[model samples]
Target: MIWEKLKEWMGGGEDGNGEFQPEWITLLEKNLPLYKRLPDEMRQHLHERIARFVESVRFEGCNGLDVTDDMILTVAAQACLLVIHRDGVPYPGLRTVYLYPSTFSSIHKSVDAMGVVTEGRVHRLGESWETGTIILSWDSVEQGARDIRDGSNVTFHEFAHQLDHEDGPTDGAPGLASRAAYRSWARVFSESYADFQELTERGRKTVMDAYGATSPAEFFAVATETFFEKPRQLSGKQPELYEELVGYYGLDPREWLP
Candidate 1:
């Protein structure tokens, strides 16, 4: 059954143009604000990607939550947006997604300069692991879907980590076309990240979230959220960084704007 679903998703439906169920379309139109803004061709492509993801990946309900088909589609659609214009299988390294009812607490460990480790429980909305696993708060997912222009989406943020980990460990850089692309990406992201960190330190408003200042890997994720949600603003303020993302993703989100 799963194989058949995968075939249908990849091969396109009876219409031969990447069709989705009418109910699914309605749900997406209501919950995902960006869905309405996408060009017809892109929306079709996204439908195929979401279907492929829903069939291939395992989704589990955590902490007494029950994973529903609607929930899976909602989350998968947002995740598929990242790879909608890229080639190859979607998220080849990913296998499972665990959904929670709301914010959850987990143990967090940190080491000091003295080499002493301290551990405590911290509340989290989502997590992406290199071990083919992701955990998310369903409420947060819904919140992200409802507001597409906020430049903040836990689904996009975590999936960005998944993309960053595809080549190896989670670095600020994902797999680029060539050494030159890699070099350019490194130089641009390094400089942009440093500037982002300084701006964050001064507590100034930024197009990107301050949480991105946490690390290079995190900067990439945050920038991804900004790129998709606030493409025009990001392009205006950070043209170089926006150009790099456009080169990598193979899509210019500014086209989605009116």
Candidate 2:
């Protein structure tokens, strides 16, 4: 909550005069539009967040791609947005972010109880690890930034997973402020997750992505992407889920809704 704010006030990322850097502001303006739409105070928080994140985490380009300040700020700013109105260090366990020029491939293998091993290769846009490693496709990150209302963001989606992993298992539920809050989270998310799961399975058009049915973890990540990107549509189509997300995030994106 105020921990990050206090740290910034104590000169965590502020300049000698305790001001947000002009260079950082220029990078944000040139790279991401949604950051520009933030309210002034929230924007300042995001600025401090980006500064700390850029300093804390390692941003390495893979496959011959060169990561730039624009790329770093774009990702850091969006990740910090999730915490702008909430608590704790942003990505407390995270240490590294790997950026790829485009979608990357990974091998998926599973063994069934019948002693059968299945293997497949899947192309991915973003992925997060319990070891605090985050991988992303630069292409999707830029695309999400270019069009902010698409209800899809690789960076946001993956970082939400990081939050899910914070308390313990990668279950859809995150660590709430209290026991009552946890109960509310469990009830609302369980009901909505089931309903959304059924809606997707029935091949009906839904506001949330069908991929969310993959698991509760995926559902939470997808919910996060929709909560910020397509706030109006999500609020209209899934008011209950919207309220749940609003409660959890402590920020209402309807002000930036298009």
Candidate 3:
């Protein structure tokens, strides 16, 4: 009811659904032209959805982090682009975004075999929860916007987890449009993940980051960062996985960048 009221107050008059508007598109055009490097149609498609997502999520700056409106919109735009060409499925459960000045520590919660709760601090640049809250660091976000080749992006990584959670848990599986797509996705990801793990174990060099060897979930998120950031490298090294991601995201970074 509050969101509905806020939606109406925000001049989202049509159906009071808080949908994106032409004004937001104009604002995005004026503020986020960097994304214009993408094809015109693709840019337009992403603009509206990105604006809507930015509007829907609440952002807070912590530890004196200067959370500029443009910075938030830019980060949200890039993250939302990964899902723009797909069907409409609202980001399940994510509403608040807490931004920090830099990498922060989070208390990790775990249960032992005896049902004892263990708590430990884990330093991170970004994190996403199934309950709809995503936390990110401003420094990490700024770095990501500047360097697209490092295969490290707080926005992409956290949002990839958001996508993965749509299917339930963030086990590297997102909701696919069809069963056939799921089968293909599973095969390529399984093989690539395995190969990356073996490479890491053998202390071999990899184009992608070794962080992917952390877990299947981390593998998916890290691979997503590489998929968008270093599309040429990912495609050259793991063509099948690249194709699967292209199919899922519906946009080819190679075409955009090249």
- lDDT per residue for candidate 3 within 1-258, as digits (tens), equals 223333453465345555445554554555444375678777656755654666678888889876775567657777788778654544646788899988999899998899999999999999999988889988788778666667778888999999898888788988898989888888888999999999999999987889999888999898899998889999999999898888888778898666
Error of 1 at 214 (Å): 0.9
TM-score of 2: 0.90
Q: Which candidate gets the maximum TM-score versus the true structure?
A: 1
What tens-digit string does per-residue lDDT give for candidate 2 at 115-177? 999999999999998899999999999888768877888888999999898999999998789
Error of 2 at 91 (Å): 1.4
Q: Which candidate, 1 or 3, has the higher lDDT? A: 1
Estimate, for each residue in 97-161, the C-alpha lDDT of model 1 and write its tens digit: 99999998999999999999999999999999999999999999999989988999999999999
> Against the hidden reference, what TM-scores do the models get?
0.93, 0.90, 0.83
Candidate No. with top lDDT: 1
lDDT to native, each model: 0.88, 0.84, 0.78
TM-score head-to-head 1 vs 2, winner: 1
